[model samples]
Target: MKITIAYIEEPPFGWTGRDQAAMGADIELADVVLRAIGVSTIHHHLTSFDELLPGIQEGRWDMNVPLFVTPERAQRVAFSVPVWSIGDGFLLHCGNPKVLTSYEAVAARSDARLGIIAGQVQFESAKSAGVLDRQIVLFKDQPDAISALRAGMIDAYASTAVGNRVLAESADNAALEAVAHNNGGDGRVPIGAFSFNKSNHDLIKAVNKRLIEYLGSADHRARMERYGLTHTEIDGAIISQSAKY
Candidate 1:
């Protein structure tokens, strides 16, 4: 059998590498799980982030992996039990003068402008933390958002912790840093999951069963670490699934 998976660019989760191959922890994991379930051929389709859900709904793709699940999204697509939970963070100048590490901090400032990729959980989280829509400056992708932050066009760039870390570590960005979101409480930690067309109930179940097995393995741990995820984070994510959701 064969399957087509759609995704947008988000490092450590999913992206088109320099060689134009779909590569990331989530992409590789999906490949492994699909092959294990007798999917001999897998196709990766790159779509605009804004199009992922609508594309899935229209059957433009068989599925979408690397979506950060929320109640709103779950209502639209069938989500497999989350592979892990991760939170948003900020990529800021070296000094982080405004200390915009968490959404709450940005929300607290009337003058603060935060750059976020359009249609991402970071945008949702910012709103949840009381950020007004006017204060948000949506960019088309991470590079654009990062550029805005670097050029002082935005106070900070909001995105995933792993993504920010990867960006800040780049040679050209030596003056920036990645700061994890810790707002004195659980402030909008999103569970990451693959989304399937709502009608693919059997396929969702099959993938979820295989995913759970894969998540429990040492191979998963190594794959995650390669993308800068800490063991504690994934472990807590698994436990939180049962405890909170």
Candidate 2:
């Protein structure tokens, strides 16, 4: 059987490596789990963050792995058990002058403008933190949002913690710094999972069963460390009640 997986180039989760190879913890996990279930071939479809769900819904792919499992998303796709738990992070100008570390901090500042990728979970987290719609500037992707921050168009670029770390450490972003949680409320950790087209229940069930076993194994930890994920990040993993099969 063949399985087509849709993914975006979000560091630590999904990205093309130096040799133009598809890589990242999520991809490896998907490969292992699918192959265990008799999937003879695996094809990865590189897509934009905005395209993940729509691609699945449109039958462009069999699954979208490693996306945050939001209730809104669950309505459109069948999400498997949580594969990882993630929190919000920010890419801020050097020195973090205002000491802005969380979404609550940004919300408290009337002059603050936050750059967020359109359709990302961080957008909703910002809103939940009392950030006004006007204060939240939506961008098409993380790079664009980070550019706006460097140009002073926005105070900070909001995204996943590991993602922001990758951005801050990249050669082009040496002037920026990363912080762990932007939501300010105990890390706004949300469970992430593989998204299957709603009609693919059989595939979803099989993947979920294997995923749970994989996540609890030492192999997953090895993958996490190899991908630059921190110990806290691994420990932060949580199961989502809504995502359980």
Which prediction has the highest lDDT against the true structure? 1
Q: Scored by CA lDDT, what does every candidate get?
A: 0.83, 0.82
Candidate 1 Cα errors over 4 Å, as ranges? 183-188, 241-245
Residue ranges of candidate 2 with Cα displaced over 4 Å: 182-188, 238-245
> Which lDDT tens digits does candidate 1 get at residues 53-121?
999888888889767877888888888877877766888899889878678888899889999888887
Across 103-133, the per-residue lDDT of candidate 2 in tens digits comes to 8888899889999888988888889989999
Report the C-alpha displacement of residue 172, candidate 1, in angstroms. Answer: 3.5
Q: Pick the candidate with the highest TM-score.
A: 1
RMSD of 2: 2.5
